[model samples]
Target: MQRAWVIQFAGLAAILLLLAFALPRYAQMVPEKIADHVQHHLHEKGMTWAGVRPAPGHSRSVLLNGSAPDAEAQQAAVNDLRSLWYIQQVQDTTTPKIIEPYTLHIQWDGDKLALDGYVSSAEDKAEIAEQIRSEFGNNADLEKLQAGLGAPEYWETLIHTVLLKEIKPLPSASVRMVGHTINFAGKVATTQKAEALSKALRPIEEKDYHLAVNIIPLDIIEPYTLHIQWDGDKLALDGYVSNADTKAKLVEQIKSAFGDNAHLEKLQTGSGTPKHWETLISTVLLEAIKPLQSASVRMVDQTLSFAGKTDTTRQAKALEKALQPFAAKGYATSVNVIALDNAAVVCQREFNRLLTQETIVFSTGGAGIHQESNALLQELADAAIFCAGTTILISGHTDDVGNEEDNFKLSEQRAKAVKGWLFRQGGVPLERMKTSGKGASEPLADNDTEAGRAKNRRIEFVVEGI
Candidate 1:
């Protein structure tokens, strides 16, 4: 029994070893067999036979690697193999591909511009250099090291007429032309300039040739600098300007606006500053805020930075609005607008607190101001004076104890009485004040309770026209 078991085990082991050797041999011979079959057919067709490679782990797929003078001849060889049923798949690996025409490039930096690429002829090169000089001004640094067969007639015309003109305004720009496609990149001084350049190139877009543009605003150092200081007592001005004439005009305007209270130490240097800069500072920035306690204005390059304290929030808002034109034109700006303690905002909060704690009581149903509200009214008046260029809105309300018509009439009368008191006692102008009544239509608390009703029957003040 033991001898018979050993013979069975040996026979099984031999069969396993045979499979390991035979499978790889079969895998190795596949490509050779396919090569033979492919060669036999290729010989009859007068085509040379290149080697064949079987696809890894795939039984029928193979890579028929070969080359031909042209794509048409290569396709013909591939089509011949498709008729045979044995080869399931064939990937034709061929060489000598069709390529597009070469590209040309031009780069501009500061005052210098460099051109490097191929052109069809020496005349085309000279023409391109001349075109650059004309478009970018005579001061532009130009270098051309381009060579090739005479450029295509279309390319030569496009560079001279359209592309050169489009990139002229850019302080720094690069242009690349690939066949019919042209791409542009550069820096402009304003958002409007960038948009204008983009709009101009829209006509150049076509099915055969394409045009692309990218422009970033120049935001380094601005042309001039403005240094303004308000030291809680008086204002001081100093910094760089475009020229002596501009400085004289600006100083005169500042003196006119603030009178002898301001000091000027400004120097004029003809940097790259904008023409409308004086108008921007004296007209927009300074006009927004008056009666400042402390402030400073600094402008560098195309950016404006200001820090200061105003007596009221209204002044701050006006200053922000005044700077809108600069922001819209792509001037980077920042403002630190600090409202003083005596500002209207602080007074407004105090008024709200006083009204919430103690109601402005009137005698019965009459439009008489009560004595208890004397001190608070005086405080509200003091706040109103500081908040210049704003209007005061006084609204009155009453609990729903009577008919709607009677309640509305009483509210209106009470509001008018308060307005008269503010005008007579507080000295606030009538044109800067308006009075209204809601007859308990708008309430701060539930009217079902006595306390809530007391809270609802009150006078409220709102600041408008800020």
Candidate 2:
């Protein structure tokens, strides 16, 4: 009976040993048991932990500090052969503690970034870690920056949130924060931007907010004004160029005879009447100032005349000289010399009686128009002779450089407007005229560069059907 009992006990002992090995592992992973194995082994071997700080991944397993004398030995006690697999990196560090001789602390983990605690020399303790670069030098992930903290989620959240955010003790020209309240006082270019920022920060409703921003607009300085218009023989000052500088310039150009010319300032004021002799006199004087038909200025209003019977050659020279001032200032002209002569009364009379007639167009426009083209327009308009049933086709066109759709719209609109002015504004019947739009497609010049583009962007009128 004793022998039989011994055999049964031996069989039981063998079975128990087999179960011990089999149950601790399901396939290759018994993680809970592994942790217990590691913890128990380390404790038994007198391993010490200095810190368990945050790192940059989902798992918080990275050790920032340990005071184990042998990393492999400690790992062995924990049932892990991981440190021994890479023998060169298992650097041993120790400090003089009473219990153990030299407690080795790991200085690095392969070529990966080492946190502040990884650089433990007895003398080394920097607030931030010095990055231990990899052996593969040139092909480094230069832009992949590493930051401190444990789990990656924690570090990612921190960096992203603070990229452009005003950090605690926010920096600024005139903003101050106390507790959760912010006070701002300074000039801002626009109130809209400030209000937008305030709206974005409204999440912190408990915080008090105060802000003051000033706004200023600068749009009054015009480059230049269209003050004067003249054909060769006729001239006029637009009553609209009444700014102080333009008025002063016009007065200065007329010199001694035109002192304190009140019309200069009242050009756009529209106070003076053509029936008033003084106003009429000023208009006639301005008209006579054009050089195409020279008439002597007498400061005379009622009997404004061109009575000089000097020969044609001498007259042309004097007329050209008189026009020189307007010419230099971009008022080119083709005023009828016959109108200025005693031969004719009106520009139409001049064309019918003394000169051949042709349809003419005139434009008094901004400085951007070509000087030569502008001079031609005025000369043509002044000399044009119209009759009751005469077909006057004043075909207007614009420069061909804007958004394709917008240019088409503009061209058509302008053509319709000119047709309206001829029939309604100028009182010519609608059926006698028409309009057309040939946008940037019909450019007379190249559209490749600025100068050509400017030239292409012009307004012109031609006699189409007539």
Candidate 3:
């Protein structure tokens, strides 16, 4: 009977030893499991910065550490941990993140939209990111934002309104919000669009949001061209000017010069004109072509050209002298001037008499006028002066002594040579004369004899526009 009692007591002692060994280990394992489950629950609730660990001497309780974005977030993390089945209590040791002068910046540089700065919570950040993705597709950068405290009231609403309504519609734009102040800047393709944007943003300013808007309108012009015409009675201005002020100044100058007989033909305002553009146009108008009977001046980018008519060789020479300064300034100038007098029929008769009395001569087989023919050419130029208002056609003839093509070219060169001499020596405008060649086609006598061929190889002057 005593041996049976001793065996039962030994079994009880073995069971007690087993219990003593496993209790501490199982207690340690229970706290670890609870801590792990609480940590996972906090992470799932977007409290990634919150850490969970078992409270000392308390298996069912956890301590939440690390920084939360705000007091509300810290409390939410504690509540999430406490909701776990194995966690009976949660002790939070977290601080709310505080950022002074909280700011949000959005930049859209024509192609890409970038979001930067801070929001109040992850929810707000996610909402802003989703909005950006919806509007900009893959052309957005939203990684710079962080959740924190100190954001202004209704910050999310203000950001959303500015992003989707104002900044999204612009080609290039930016929005910056600091505390209660908002600054919006954008670029538009035209003045109308800029005005529209300003109007659209007026409500934000009126609501006392401390808004400042700077919308710029682009005014770029390519291949700038300006044309001015004067038709004996009235002056006309056409093509592009730089701005309203420039166009107004030009109209005032034109009216002053032409005595109020000026016309405006679709003169537009733009940018991107050459340097000294206004100065060039003004000089050409008031100095170069003012005294002419009829004229047209055209400026294509850096080049300036004009054509006109005057009543005297003196006036033509003066016009050429007036354009010298512009030419010296590296601008291309094409000047054509015609000197026209009203006595056409009388000048024609005088030319016939002069040519019948003497013949103008040139070098053999060349276009150079012979020195001996100077006296005869001087007489012919003197006669041509009276017919300045008419087109004097100088016709040259050659005998059938060479190729027809060669003779034809030679005759034309001789005619031009005569015109050149009249311009250089007698002060006649080159545009007042025309030249032609008749290579043995029109014979005054015949090509069979020397005297006849000499007569055929002569020059004739005919005055037209009588």
Using lDDT as the measure, name the better of candidate 2 and candidate 3: 3
Give the Å shift of residue 19 in candidate 2. 5.3
Against the unseen true structure, what C-alpha lDDT does each candidate score?
0.71, 0.37, 0.80
Ten-residue segment with the worst summed lDDT in candidate 1?
141-150
Taking all chains together, the TM-score of candidate 3 against the true structure is: 0.45
| lDDT for each residue of candidate 1 in 88-140, tens digit (9 for 90 to 100) | 88777755322247577877775766766666555667777787776666765
Reference-based TM-score of each model: 0.34, 0.25, 0.45
How does candidate 3 score on lDDT? 0.80
* Counted clashes in each candidate structure: 9, 21, 4
Q: Taking the tens digit of each residue's C-alpha lDDT, what string does model 2 give over 1-466?
A: 9999999999999999998898655523443344344445445556544222222222213223355433443343333423423211222232322221111111121222212211122122221222223221232232323221122122222212321122212212233322223333332233344445455444334223232322111221122222343333333444333235545654665544433432343244221111232333334445345333333332121222232212244564565455444334333333334322322233334333321223222243222223344334434333332233334444334455557777665655555655554454355567755566666767767878876765554434443333
Superposing every Cα of model 1 onto the true structure, what RMSD results?
Answer: 18.2
Per-residue lDDT tens digits of candidate 3, residues 1-466?
9999999999999999999999999999999988887778778867798887888878898888987777678877777676667777878788887888899888998789887889898888888888888878888888898788988776787677744567776889988888878898888888678878888876666556788888777765667888878768888877887788988888888778778777786788886667878877776556666778877678888787776677877887888888777677777877756566535665777688888887777889988898988888876786676455678999999999989999999999999999999999977788889999987898888799999988888888888866
Which numbered prediction scores highest in lDDT against the true structure? 3
Model 3 alpha-carbon drift over 4 Å, by segment: 1-13, 43-50, 66-72, 84-86, 95-118, 121-236, 242-246, 258-263, 270-466
